[model samples]
Target: MRVQLILSEALSGLRRNASMVVSVVLVTFVSLTFVGAAMLMQMQIGKMRDYWVDRAQVAVFMCREGAATTTCTGGVANQEQLDAVREKLESPALAGIVRDIRFEDREQAYQNLLELEPDYADLVTADQLNETYWVNLVDPSQTDVIAEAFGGMDGVEEVRDQMQYLEPLFSALTVATYIAVGIAVLMLVAAVLLIATTIRLSAFARRRELGIMRLVGASNRFIQTPFILEGVFAALLGSLLAGGAVVAGMYFGVDRYLRERVPFVTTWVGMQDAWIVIPLLVVIGALLAALSAGFAIRRWLRA
Candidate 1:
């Protein structure tokens, strides 16, 4: 009997202020959607970084043709110095740290470059190229070991690692995601405020009825339960709608679109990850709505 009464009152409250309820749902949906997108972006970035960092290699460019025995002069690598660097990299001192190493001759590098820019075929002859020792490590973090071994060494011109290139991209994406998440949080705060105002207004409009209920000795919980339920319901619906749209976009749209166009771009936050995130979004929405409604009722009712 008590449950039936609260449900009836909640439905009536929603019907009485349908416009306000709809407004609340819309705001909640937009805020939660932004938050969800930012989280998905962060997950993708983490997956990609882990993939690349683990599999990345440090390229040690060898002495090009007609280069001196000295090191790093005019961007050319020499033969004797190249051998010294290779021996040290392959030495037992670095055995566990270094997984595998491959040497790329001038012709191979030229062929790879051709694959890169087919139109720039005549940019350079094969003889003008320098061979490089591309080192794939078991541990990418042990880059300093290779650096310490090869730095200022003979025959090798320079060593470039993955961190030099990929760090900047990750940093930029992370900053952008943080900014997006920040905006979503501010919008969520605004939604909470709107909910509070709407609840306060509803309470004011029903003051006479609440007074009668109190005079009849009804518990405060009995009167406030419906309002709190209304908020929780609105939040749940809004979050579900937002989560549905995001899941659809990620699975049906973004994945297909990116795969069709940029197949090389990889992401780990797929359909499975979406399932995990949905519950979190729902919980966030529920908490926001319930807390906002409860605070408004408690404070305003005190007066």
Candidate 2:
């Protein structure tokens, strides 16, 4: 009976302040949507990092004819210099660090270039390309070891860790995630304040009824329950809308469009990630509403 009465009162208050309720819903929806987007962005970043890190290799580019580096001043890397580089890679000092080594000779490098940029075939030749040792490390993070070992060697032009190029992309994504978080936080504060305002107005509109209940010996908890429920109901509706937005974005934006257009990003945040985000949005929305409404009503009662 008490639960039914509380529900009835809560519904009545919502209907009385219909426009304010809509405002709360809209604010909550926008805030939670930003929250969900931030989460999915971080997840996408993690997937990219994991995928690239596992396959990252160190390219030890041997000096080609006319190489400008001081170490390659002898025109091209001779057979003895090439052999010395290979011996050092296979030496006992680097046995545990070097997982696998594949040598790409000048012709193979030229062919790969042609495959990537077919226009280059007419202008470039095999001898113009550098022979490279593609070294897969046992631990990708230990790239510095390989770089230090071969960086200034007679036959080597440069030691390039593939991850060096990828770091900038990852850093850019991280900055975007932080910006989303900042926007979400600001919107959430607006939602909380709006919820508090709505509850105080509802209490003020029904002040006479509250006084009657107080005179009838009703407890403060009983007086506060209906107002708290009103806030929670509005916030819940907003959270549901936000969840739908996240699901649709993952499906249409990521799965259908991005997956086809952005071939380089093999992995993406999918419906599974959306499912994880939905529950979190609900919990956050409902908890914030309940607290804000409860605090607002309690202050009104004291006044």
Candidate 3:
């Protein structure tokens, strides 16, 4: 009976402040949606980084004919130079760091270039290509070690870490995530303020009932329960809406569109990720609303 009465009073308060309830709902919905999006973006960034880090290699390009580098003045890497490089790689100094190394001769390099850019078939020849050593490190971050070892070596033109090209992309994504988080925080503040205002107004409208209940010796918890419930109910509705939006976006935007359009990104935040965000959104919304409403009503009662 007590639970039913509290629920009835909460519903009545919501009806009295219909416009404020709607505002609270909309604000919570937008804030939680941004929160979910920021989380998924971070997750996508992690997936991409993990996928690329495992596969990214340090390319050691051997000197080709007519190369300009001082180390390539010998014109091209001779068999003796290649053997020396192989020996040094297998040497005790680098054995622990180098996980695997694959040597690609000019012909293999040319074939790969042709496969990637067919138009170059007629313009480029096999001899023009550099014989390369693709080195996979046990830890991708140890690229500088390989660079230091081979950068000034005879018959080596250049040593390039593939991750250097990818850092800018990751940095850009991180900035975007920060922007989303900033927007979500601002919206959440708005939602909390709206919830507080709504609860205070409801309490003011029922001041007479509250006074009578106080005279009848009703506890503060019982009196505050209905107003807190009103805020929680509105927040819950908004959270549900946000959850639905996140699910739809993952399905249509990520799964159907991005996965197909962006072939390079093999991994994406999927339905499973959305499921995780949905529950989090609900908890965040409810907790924030409860605290805001509870605080607002407590202050109003004291006043």
Candidate 4:
């Protein structure tokens, strides 16, 4: 009888204050959406780090104009130095880490450059082109070791891994992710406080009933159940809304936008990522709401 009464009262409160209920839910949903997006962005960074690590290019840029010795230091890699570098890269000590080595002469690099930007053809002539090695490592993680080994070598003016190119982009994403997550956290705390306030108002409205119950044989558990249930239900609804919004945002907007428009970000988050994030967010939302409501009720009970 007590359980049924509590459930009935909970339903009545929800129906009576539908607007407030909706407000609580909407706030929760928006808050959780931000949380989900933050998680997704973090995952996206992890994905990029993983994918690029395997494909990082080890570059061996030769020197400029020739000097006394055909050395590459401040000059282009001569035939002998280039050949020796290739042999060292192919050696057994490095073979496990060396995937494929391609040599691009000054002329080839210029031709490729001209192909990319014909208008710049007049800017740089093939004669001034510098020969470089496009070294593909078996694993990108080995970049530090390989780069250190060959960077200061006799013929190499500079050794650079293409992954260095992605540093700026990753750094930017990291900053954005942190900022977004921080904002989401601040908003979530606000939502929690609002929910507590709203639930407290509802409790105040039912103060007469609570007072009557206290005078009667009602236990603390009996009086608190309905309020707890109310908070739980509100949180659950909000989570569903937020989770759905996140999935839609990713599917129609993020996924399609990236896949069709920007090819680079596609590899960052796959379909699997969405599948994983949704359920996780839903769980988070439900738990957060229930806990918030429980805390609110306990606070009101003390009063």
lDDT tens digits by residue: candidate 3, 119-221: 9999999999999999999999899999999999999999999998899999999999999999999999999999999999999999999999999999999
The alpha-carbon lDDT assigned to residue 295 of candidate 3 equals 98
**Segments of candidate 1 deviating more than 4 angstroms:** 65-79
lDDT of 4 by residue, 1-303 (tens): 867888998888787667888888888888888888888989989988888877778887777575334345446566788888888988999988888988888789988998889998878887676678788887777888887788667877777888878989999999998888888788778777777776788889999999999999788888887877787788788888877887788888776677788776547576678778888877876677667877888889897
Q: Which sections of candidate 3 miss by over 4 Å?
A: none
Q: lDDT per model, in order?
A: 0.83, 0.95, 0.96, 0.80
Candidate 1 on 1-303: residue-level lDDT in tens?
999999998888888888988988999899998888888889889888988988789988776766654675645655566677778888999899889999999889989989988976877878777788889898889898787778677667667796778899989989989997998899899889988887887888788989999999998888888888888888888899989978987877677676678666665578887887888899999999999999888887688
Model 4 earns a TM-score of: 0.89
Native-vs-model 2 lDDT?
A: 0.95
TM-score, model 3 to reference:
0.97
Q: Which stretch of 10 consecutive residues in model 3 shows the poorest summed lDDT? A: 264-273
- TM-score of structure candidate 1: 0.93
- lDDT value for model 4: 0.80
